[model samples]
Every structure is written in structure tokens, then in C-alpha cells.
Target: MTAPVLEIALLQVRPGQTPAFEAAFAQAQSLIAGMPGYVRHDLQRCLEDDHRYALLVWWETLEAHTVGFRGSPQYQEWRALLHHFYDPFPTVEHFVDVTPGRLPPS
Candidate 1:
């Protein structure tokens, strides 16, 4: 069995485009949810910055996101719907469970 991985991205919506971007993301999230090995995800808006967001996606493995999702055609649609809203574009990173005994932090 493979340990779960967390895919994190800091999303910075273009000025005045937060609402539009959020609407698009609402439609695009399903594409990620339906993929193989997908666990769950959360999209959170920064209280300090309304135009900034954090996307935290949990997958069964890194490849489940980097290979399965990004390599699929659905990703194209996902990109089309949400990519343009980004300002400098977000940097996505992957992380693994670190705590040895307790449940991972939410």
C-alpha cells in the first residue's frame, strides 16, 4: 500500500478576478476528485488576502497526481477553466505524512 501525499499550491487570483476564478474552480474541482487514487481536497481563501488561495489535495500517491491527473485529458479542461485566473501562476508542491504515530494534521 502507498502512503498518501499532499499536493499544495498557493493560488494568487488576478486582481478583481477572485469571484470568477472561484466560480470556475467550483466547476473544475470535480475533474480532480474523480481521478484514481484521489483522497480528498480543500480550497481555502486567505483571510489576509481575498485574492489569494490555498489548494490542498490529498492523493494516495505522488504519481496519482503528477502522472494520472496531469497526464489526462481532463486536465486540459481543468486548465482551460482555471488557469487564466492565476497572476504569476501557482507553484505546486508535494508532501508526505510526517508524524509517525498520530493522525496527520488537517
Candidate 2:
């Protein structure tokens, strides 16, 4: 089986917009959750900076997110709901496990 891919996005919301951005994300989360090959996701706020967040998503493969999710119509809605809240916009990247067996059990 192909190893899963991890998507990471360091988001910086415009100052004073964190509350609204988080509300929008609550609605947008379902769009990603229903996509093909989606494993799981999490949104974590930074303690040092209230305007910063980390978005992590696990997919069955790279294409499952880069192609399947981002290319879908749902992504448009996802953008509409959450994109405006970003200041400079977030950079998204993907990764594969270098030591899969080293990960602690969930």
C-alpha cells in the first residue's frame, strides 16, 4: 500500500480576524473530511501568536489532496469561506513519513 501524505499549511490570519476565520473553518472542515483518500485533519492555534495557525491533514496519497481535493468544486467553497481571512496567504506543502514505524501509536 502507498504511504500516506501529510499536508502542512502555516496560516497567518489578518490581525483581529481569528474569531471569524475559525468560525468559517468550522464550516469548511466538512468539505475536506468528505474527500476521497482523506484520512484526518487538525487545526491548531499558536500560543505565541493568536493570529497564527497550523493546518495539518493526512491523505492516503499526494494526489488525493493536490488533485482530488484542490481540483474539486468544494475547494472553491473552501477558498471563499477561508481565503479572505488570510493576510499574506498561507503556503501549503506535503510530506511523506521518513520513519513510518517510529511514529507512536494513536
Candidate 3:
């Protein structure tokens, strides 16, 4: 079986837009949570930089995000609801766990 992939995005929201961005993200979360092959996700704010956020999403495969989600209509809605809050567009990347075994079960 293929290991899961993690999508990482470092988001720099416009100054003074954190609250709006966070509120929009709350609404947008459901769009991603319901996608096929989605494992889970988290959006964390930076302590040093309140305008910054780290978005981590785990998916069953890379295509589950690059194709399955990005190509779906929900992504358009996701973009519409949250895109404007960004300063410069965020760069998204995917990674697989490199350890001998993944994280221990909780």
C-alpha cells in the first residue's frame, strides 16, 4: 500500500486580516474534509508572526490533493472564500514520511 502524503502551505495573510482569514478558513475546512482520500488537516498560526499560518493536510496520495481536490469544483469555492486574504500567494508542497515507520498511534 502507498503511504500517505502531507501537503504543506505557508500562508502569509495580509496585515490585519488574520481574523477574516481564520473565519473564512473555518467555513472552507468542510470543503476539504469531505474530499475523497483526505485523512485530516490543521491550520496553525505563527506565534512570532500573527499574519502567518501553516496549513498541513494529509491525504491518501498526492493525486488526492493535486488532482482530486484541486481539480474539483469545491476548490474554486475554497479559493473564492479564502484567496483574497493572502498577501503573496502561498506555495504548496507535498511530502511523505521518511522515518522507518510513521508516527506511533495515539
- Candidates in order have lDDT scores of 0.93, 0.94, 0.94
Instruction: State each model's C-alpha RMSD to the native.
Output: 2.4, 2.3, 2.1
lDDT of 3: 0.94
Using TM-score, rank the candidates from best to worst.
3, 1, 2
Model 2 local distance difference test score: 0.94
> Cα deviation of 13 in candidate 2 (Å)?
0.2
For residues 72-105, write the lDDT of model 1, one tens digit per residue: 9999999999999998889999998777796654
The per-residue C-alpha lDDT of model 3 at residue 51 equals 96
- Candidate 2 local lDDT, 1-106, one digit each (tens): 6668999999999999999999999999999999999999999999999999999999998999999999999999999999999989899999987885676334
Q: State the displacement of the C-alpha of residue 1, model 2, in Å, after optimal TM-score superposition.
A: 2.7
Candidate 1: lDDT over CA atoms? 0.93
Model 2 C-alpha RMSD to native:
2.3
Better of 2 and 3 by TM-score: 3
TM-score, structure 3 vs. true? 0.93
Task: List where candidate 3 sits over 4 angstroms from the true fold.
Answer: 101-106
